[model samples]
Target: MTSLPEDPPSAISEGDRDTAVQRLQEAYSQGHISHEELDERLHQVLTARTRGELVAALASLPEENAGTTSTIAAAAGRIKRRGAWRVPRILKVESAYGRVRLDLSRAVIEHPVVDIELQLGTGRATITVPRDATVEFEDLRTGWKDTRYKPRARSRPGGPTIRICGTMGYGRLKIRHAWR
Candidate 1:
């Protein structure tokens, strides 16, 4: 049998291609590659017309990062729990495509002025307001038929005042903290 040169043929060996796929899979499972990145890379590899291109793709493994914790709190003691005093007089909140809940069951007896902003892609929101506080609704934009306001039969004075700005796509929003 004749011995081949150190350099393999232009065609990629089955073992080399398999090893590349394995390395890519391991990188993804170990969280080294994001789903979008992995998909793009895999697409590039599988679509390579020549063996050299495939080999070049296989050699492009990204560097590993240990990640930083200066901005991340890993322990329970590092978390900040605000007392009643820190509660905002006017709670301004914003979100997209999801409902947000604000629980005031443990709130102090203080008049709160709340401002809410939501850019919902497709969802609903239900807000529970204490009785007696006045509410004002401002509709920025909505894809739904109309915005519905469901209020409690009773009202409580000196409660929270709610101001809402929202854009809903086939969704509903309820602001209950308003006093009528």
Candidate 2:
């Protein structure tokens, strides 16, 4: 007799699930994912009720984050470098929330900073940084329950440094970094 197919979370699609996992893994390796936080997100992705829910969760993630294929990159999003010597990076993203602009360009790049600024209009966000990179926060506030920053290891020199600033009209924000 033929065997039955596995359930969605179990038989999670490679594209979306894999993407999400990879993003999660990258964040973990970069010292951006804490054990507890990782477990929680993993559970969410696996047990999500609908494809749209999963898609939204994964799609609204920060760059260099970890997870499997479930998370797909947001298209139509833009990241541009305005300056020359000290690149002034600008990220303009349109999500379920309104518009948002993230300014970095001047962020120290010696540690290979990868600043990820997202406009999460009533949406969630996930940002991952190198294991040894330093992290600083400013004007951080959240309305979602259990809003917290996942702990991460510090990054070595030349490793990527990620700075993520977002406007959450109404949502959660998870920032993972490489710092004490």
Candidate 3:
């Protein structure tokens, strides 16, 4: 088997393309790229078959410069991001033998998409998102009962998208849609 030196093709997993999609959407929301450009690149990112192709989709975007704002809800404590608190671009929640609730139904989102990472240990997390918002939580194990997030169609533009990724052991994270 011979490989092309210029375009060395490698399998591009959905995870790889998803990261590129996230970057493209962020660039579009930040006004770094036009809507038409976003649509074009998004198509490429979604349909990319090779690593080279996915890499090209994000080749033009600037490096990630967005600052991350993190928080930890320790054991035996409860934390809530509610009321008028300004939503940060990146929010991290770590709860150990505690409970954490992020009520995004009333949160003032500063970005079109928010990346939230959770680290839970024998704790519980409840996320409340607005009726219009979409949540994508990857494979997560919550003790004996695994949290199952049904995959929906790719989120539409102009609405908030929250991507939650993390590792949990003997803990549970629940997402509830706004009621109203």
Predicted structure 3: lDDT: 0.70
lDDT of 3 by residue, 62-113 (tens): 7665576867567668877775455678888887767788887656554557
Preferred candidate (TM-score higher): 1 or 3? 3
The TM-scores, one per candidate, come to 0.40, 0.35, 0.56
Best by TM-score: 3
Candidate 2's residue-wise lDDT over 1-180, tens digit each? 997553232122334455566666666676776777777777777666544445444443455412211112243343222221222233334466432222223222321344444545565555443344445545344455334565543233323345555455576665554222
What is the C-alpha lDDT profile of model 1 across 1-180, one tens digit per residue? Answer: 996444222343344355556667878898877888778777767766545466456554643221211121121122222223223344444444444454433333222355545455655556554444456676547787566666645543434466666566766665554221
Task: Give me the runs in candidate 3 sitting further than 4 Å from their true place.
Answer: 1-65, 139-143, 148-157
Give per-candidate clash totals.
Answer: 7, 31, 0
Clashes of 2: 31
For model 3, what is the alpha-carbon lDDT of residue 68? 62
Q: What TM-score does model 3 achieve against the real structure? A: 0.56
Which structure among the candidates has the greatest lDDT? 3
Candidate 2's C-alpha runs over 4 A off are 1-88, 97-111, 139-147, 153-155, 177-180
- In order, the Cα lDDT scores of the candidates are 0.50, 0.44, 0.70
